[model samples]
Target: MSMNVQNCPRCGKLFVKGFAETCPACVKDIEAQYVACADYLRQNRKCDLQELHEETEVPMRQIIRFIREGRISIADSPNLTYPCEVCGNPIREHTMCDSCRQRLVRDVNQMMDEGKNNANAEKDAHHFRITDRLKDRH
Candidate 1:
C-alpha cells in the first residue's frame, strides 16, 4: 500500500505513514505494551486503569490512549472510561459524548446560517449603474 511521508509524533523522525501513527520503533514498543496489557486483561477481564498498569507494566496513559483511539474498546469491559475530546465528559464509545456531538452540530449550523445571511445581505446591497447607451434603448 502507498504510504504518506509523515513525522513520527513519538520520536520526531520522518517515515512512511501506515496503520500506526508512530514510527516503526515506537510501533514495536507500543505493540509490546499492547500485548502485555491484553495478556493481563485476558486473565482479569474487567480491571481498573491502576490495576492494569501495575499488572501489565504498561503505562496508564498508553492504555487510556489506546481506548480513546478505539484500538481497545470497553464493550465487554465496561469499567473503562475515557474523557470526551471536547468537554472532558466520561464516555464509552467514540471520542466525544452525545452532548458534545450535539453542541458541535449546532455550532456548525449556526456558522452556516451566518454565512448564508452575509451572502444574502451582500447581494441585496449590490449597486450597479446602467451606461448611457443602455439607458438610451427603447
Candidate 2:
C-alpha cells in the first residue's frame, strides 16, 4: 500500500508521512536548531531558557520540547527551566510541577476507587434478600 502524504506543518511542503511530523528539510532545520541549543548550553551551563533562546536563536517552544524530551538534562544545565503544563510554574523536568502531578495521581486513584465501588454496586443490584424483596413490594 502507498504511504500517506501530508503537508509539513512547518514549511507547508508535501511529504510522505513517517515518524517525524515535519518534512525532511524542516526536520533538518529542527535538528540544526537543537544542535545550536545544545552547543550553546554546553558552554553557558547557567543560561536560563530566555537567554538560551536569545543566544542560540532557537525558539522558546523548541527549547522547552527538548527539555521535556530529555534531549537536554536539567542537571547539566541547572538554570534551564520551562513552565509546568498545568499550573505554569517553572519546572526543569516533566510536564507538570510536583504538586500538580501528585494531585493528578490522587484524582486518578479516587476515580478508580469510585469505579470499583460502582461495579460492586452494580453486581449487588442483581441480588436481594427475601426480606428486602418483601419490603420492596410493601
Candidate 3:
C-alpha cells in the first residue's frame, strides 16, 4: 500500500491524500454545501444555477462540479449548464459539446485510417525485385 501526503488545495493544510483532493474537514464542508444546495433545489425546482449558488452560498465552481459529477441532475432545471471541457461552450450531460465530440471522433478515425494506410504502404515497399534496381541498365 502506498501512503500519500500533500497539502490540501482547499485549506492549504498538510494531509494524507486519498481519493479526495481536500482534507477530511474540507470534504465535510463540501458535503454540507452539497446538501444545502440539494435542499434548495428540492424546494425550488425551477431555480437556475446562478440562483442556486446565490441562495445556497455555495461557490459556482462547486455547483458546476456537482453537476458535472452527476450528483445533481438538471432535468428539471433547464438553465443549468457547465462549460465543455474542450471548447468552453455551455453544455449539459457530457464533458464536451456535440460539435466538439464529433470533431474529436472524426480526428481519431482519420488518424487510425492514416496509420493503416502507412502500414499498407510500408508492406508494399518491403518487396524488392532484382530487375527494379537495374531497370535503367535493362
TM-score for all models, in order of appearance:
0.70, 0.84, 0.80
Which scores greater on lDDT, model 2 or model 3? 3
Ranking by lDDT: 3, 2, 1
The residue pairs found clashing in candidate 2 are none
lDDT of each: 0.82, 0.90, 0.90
CA RMSD, predictions in order? 5.6, 2.4, 2.7
Name the lDDT value of residue 52 in candidate 3.
Answer: 92
- Quote the lDDT for 93 in model 2: 71
Q: Which runs in model 1 stand beyond 4 Å of their true positions?
A: 1-8, 11-24, 127-138
- TM-score for candidate 2, please give it: 0.84
Model 1 steric clash pairs = none
The digit string of per-residue lDDT tens for model 2 on 11-83 reads 9999999999999999999899999988888889998998999998889998888888888787987777899
**In model 3, where is the ten-residue run with the lowest total lDDT?**
76-85
Residue 98 Cα positional deviation in candidate 2, in Å, after optimal superposition:
1.1
Model 1, 102: alpha-carbon shift in Å?
A: 0.6
Angstrom error of the Cα, residue 34, model 2: value is: 1.1
lDDT of each residue in 58-138, candidate 3, tens digit only: 999999899988889989777777788899888978889999999999999999999999998998799877888889786
Superposed Cα deviation of residue 53, candidate 1 (Å): 3.3
Best by TM-score: 2
